[model samples]
Target: MFRFDWKMTLFVLLLLPVLIRLGYWQLEREAEKRDLQQLYEERQSSAPLPISGVDWSDKDIGWSRIQAEGYYETEYNFLLDNRIQSGQVGYEVLTPFRTDYGVLLINRGWIAAGPRREILPSIETPEDKAVIEATIYIPDGELMMFGEETLSGEQWPKRIQQVHLARMSEALGEKLIPARLRLSAGSAGELSIDWQTVNMQPEVHRGYAIQWFLMAAALVVLFVFFSFRRKEKPNE
Candidate 1:
């Protein structure tokens, strides 16, 4: 009678979770690719809606935690550090725009940090404030941290870069719209767009998922190959 090794069985069993997780991830990624393809097709094939909501809304939505970064701390991080762009600290200057149908939030842009905490910058705020064609997005507020330096819902003197979306919402005292708009370039006070800050493509994740799955597959194959080779060899 042959004796079975529990260690080999345990090793194979441990691979289950990795297999399940990566298998699910691969499936989810395929679904996303299909969904995006369908969305693009609808946009192309269907008659355009006379009144369209911000197209760039979710495209720019990112994980937020308000931690300042950059040489001058002159950038805002979006979507879990997905994208960053040069903008200063101040009120996150928001403006309402009346579209053909209703109103929507427009993140006109960020203001440069004031000379000191309370000293407002001399930059001009848009006076005409109507619906200028804008790019849509969502702004993440500050993230809460467990430390002495962590302060929630309080204004600070120096530049306060952070990721706390909830804190930002509390400070603003408004249920922020799900999305914001970036005023088009050449629009009043048009700020530069930092392309480097865009979130990584979902495809990158799919590729990673594939690599993990392949590694798991290789392990299983090696296990089987060794087991069969041992059975075929003559006993010493």
Candidate 2:
């Protein structure tokens, strides 16, 4: 015998769509992650290309290995906060490089945070022009902004929460390149550079998708079991 519960049915209907949508969204994300991984692998295997005359609008430029000759703009530097390395909290140093092509931001590397928040670690910048090899890194999306604190002051060695290329370019009065150069291994830089190829592996997204679908399936089974089970008759 079937007993229909309107409220329960309505709840199930509402939740089912949401669960299905989430699973599908995860699948879409998995596909995107796979495509990104493939592109990254292809770029990594290719030879290092010169930065000069490269089309900035090209979508694939983000992962490309590049070489450039430029002088560091030591005075105006940026400290990207909340970077972790070797189980220690620190900041990633970013300094501008004035190259013949254009101004490019170079992520020098990570430095440990000071003992107190008021104090900052010392960063040395090379003044001379030199050949630099690095990987192009374009930020995936907009970063969460803490507040105006990161944007305050016109001081050298400015500490920022995230790298806002447009804002920084305007502040510096120069059209900086769209992407940042992650200092390649064995490059001449003060700090350490440890970059990951991808932020999240596709397998993780696929796992999440499976979990969501399983949850949806379980919900349907539970709903059916609860609706069909007959209540025990009370003994007179």
Candidate 3:
């Protein structure tokens, strides 16, 4: 006859729920990623929309292709730190563009980092007023700060670790639009624009969910096998 191991049963009961929960969580993440990918594809396929005063209120305007006529404010610029391209350290140059409604931050492009951390790179902004085409990229959520949130400097080209629109607006002494425009190809002052909307694919999340579920199943099988196996006969 087989004997029940209450300790093993309790351990499995405790761990099974956690594993199952993790699997379900991954599945939820997969669904979210799938929806986001679909939305991105749909937006990219549509015609470019003009940036107007009425359209500014739409929160879902991010990632939408837009066109605007503005003059770039070359005096004050921001260098986004820790940006890497082709295995070389660089910074994404963000310049403010004064449009009819308000000033909008435009991510002009990327530039290679200088020899030392203290040395800043030279960024040339387009001089004349021009019509620009770009994709709107609204910064979402708060950044995880390891130390101070703002950069330590009061200079022309400020170096920043993360984008904080409110803080930046205050520093620049002008109210800027809450989003950034990623310069399109052939646009003035454009650089490498390999932007990724979704970091992980839905299939990857589904695979992780399957792994967690398999782990749970394996635990159940081992528990059953160990609990029911016949004990070895003792030598007389």
TM-score of each: 0.51, 0.91, 0.88
lDDT (tens digit, per residue) of candidate 3 on 16-114: 999999999999999987877777779878888877843777888778888889899988889999888889999998989888878888887788999
Task: After superposing candidate 2 on the true structure, give the runs of residues whose Cα lies further than 4 Å from its correct spot.
Answer: 141-143, 146-152, 234-236
Count of backbone collisions in candidate 1: 25
What is the alpha-carbon lDDT of model 3 when measured against the actual structure?
A: 0.84
- Pitting candidate 2 against candidate 3, the one with the higher TM-score is 2
Per-residue lDDT tens digits for candidate 2, residues 1-236, read: 67899999999999998998999998998898888778878987888898876888897687888888988998888888989999999999998988889988989889999999878888988888788888887565445776554444677777788888887887687889888779887776657877876667788889999999999999999999999998778982
All candidates in order of lDDT, best leading: 2, 3, 1
**What are the root-mean-square deviations of the candidates from the true structure over C-alphas?**
9.3, 2.0, 2.4
Q: Worst ten-residue run, lDDT, model 2?
A: 143-152
Error of 2 at 25 (Å): 1.8
> lDDT of model 1 at residue 35?
60
lDDT of 1 by residue, 59-133 (tens): 532221111111111122221211234433344444434444444444445555456755644434444433244
